[model samples]
Target: MTQGRSIRLFLVDGTPNGLLTAEIMNWTGHVLTGPRSKLSELVQRPECGRTGIYFLVGPDPDNSLRPLVYIGESDDVGTRLKQHNRPEDKGGKDFWEKVCLVTSKDQNLTKAHVKYLESLLIQNAGQVGRCKLINGTAHEYINLPESDRADMAFFMEQIRTVLPVLGLDFLRESFGNKAKAEPSDDAGVDSPRLYMQITKQGIQASAQEYEGEFIVMQGSTTRVDWVAQPGGYGALFAQLCEEGVLSEPEGKVRRFTKDFAFSSPSAAGAIVAGYNVNGRTTWKVDGSGITYGEWQDRQVSAAAAAAAAPE
Candidate 1:
């Protein structure tokens, strides 16, 4: 069973778009985030002077869904940020539009601790493959004591819990069974594994909706050649091919080599059918044969009824 956590968020300037701070109850780590335009104000916060790890984030020029990220650590984050705020020709980055920094409220984090955290964060981000990492190789930090390593691991877990709440999900791993996302709301009842197919082309696929993402399972079949004009779906299909997520065709059909998550079922349907599709109407619940759209509509109506019931 998963336990609930309490996180507090504060808008420093009392505006939704300005700088913000986040902290989790019982955790020593603190997080500060804001747009690059607010870099001057962010650097002035006392937390910026502490040793910490920071992330620079911006949209990928090629894939809007996957962002470009750079991770680093510094003894004095404020000074490091000032340097990064410089013009690109003066050794600063031009691609990042927002910045997020993590430090400890107790002021116990040292240069070594943050270096270790940065390395782990970089490694995890690479394994997740959710974003393009712009940093060079992560440096090794093996000299830290075993006890300190355990503590840092726990600290990283807290960071994982908080980041997603702030709309940063680059660190969230994609493997559904191993993911840390909250369980389904119906008392841990798992969603049914739904199926979709294009009979004429012999295409067959299975997927499950988990924590809002629709994951197309491994071994699902797709067309060898996409028939639609290159749009967002087309671009994503090309990306999947380039990343080798789709195996070489065995005949007229290609297979998903591993489980891949899509932002919506429609997007998954677009790739599986090799063209645009309304996944809600196309995908059917296994055994029951009910359309995904109908099942989702039932759930929505049930929730609305429950909300309107007298107490």
Candidate 2:
């Protein structure tokens, strides 16, 4: 079971897409996120001067389905961000659209502390296979004292907790059992829902609605090769293979090595079924014959009725 978190968010510019700061209750770590447009404004803040690990995130032009990430650690995060702000011709990271940095509010983090964090982040983010990492090679981890390692580990925990709230999902690591996202509060945990897809290829899979995506569980078999090669699902399927999300353990058929997330149920079904298909109609609730479309309609109808009910 996952415990609830206490986090406070501040909109520095009072706009949704502008610079933002985040804090976890009783934690020393501070997180900052903002558009690349506000680099100067962000670096001027006090926390940016501290030792920390930072991520440059943006959509991949080649794979619109996934974000591209570049991770780095610096003694003075402010200076490094400015260097990244340099023009593309000057070796700046041109692919970055937004920036996020993790630093300690108490300024107690040291050089060795952040290096370990940076190294672990790179390794795990690659394994998560969510983002397209632009970092060429993983940084080798620096050794830390026993107590220091424990502290850095805790600090890393806080970083993972707050990142998802900032709209970064680079740490969803899945290997054996399938990467399952904690049922987030905003995913309408107010209701419990499940859907099933039965493909003509004898593919039988179950999925649950999570956050805004439908996560097909691991062990779900997918066509070893996409029959088509020219559309969004095909592109996404190929990217997943490249990222190591889907693997072949047995025959020529590919299986989801972990619970994989899709933008919609149809997207999941399309990839699993090896062709284009309507997800809403393809997936159904087990035991009941109702399709996902019908189930969604029922949910909406219930909300309307409850909203219209007199107090």
Candidate 1 residues 1-311, lDDT tens each?
67888999999999988899999999999999999999989999999999999999999887766899999999999999999888999999899999999999999999999999999999888887889999967778988999999999999988888998898998975765354454642333235779998889899999887667888889999988788987758877777887778888778888999888888889999999999999898889989999999998888999999999999
Each prediction's whole-model lDDT (CA): 0.88, 0.80
- For 1-311, candidate 2 gives per-residue lDDT tens digits of 35787899999999999999999999999999999989889999998989999999998887766799999999999999988988889978788989999998899888888999988888878877778888876877757888888888788878877898888987753322232244442343322345554445556676777556687777777777788757858887888788677885356567787777777888998888778889888888767878888888998999999999999
Q: Clashes in model 2: which pairs? A: 178-258, 266-279
- Model 1 lDDT, residue 274, Cα: 90
> Could you tell me how far off, in angstroms, the CA of residue 161 lies in candidate 1 after the best superposition?
1.0
Model 2 residue 207 CA deviation (Å) reads 2.7
Off by over 4 Å in 1: 176-190, 229-232, 298-311
Model 2's TM-score against the true structure: 0.76
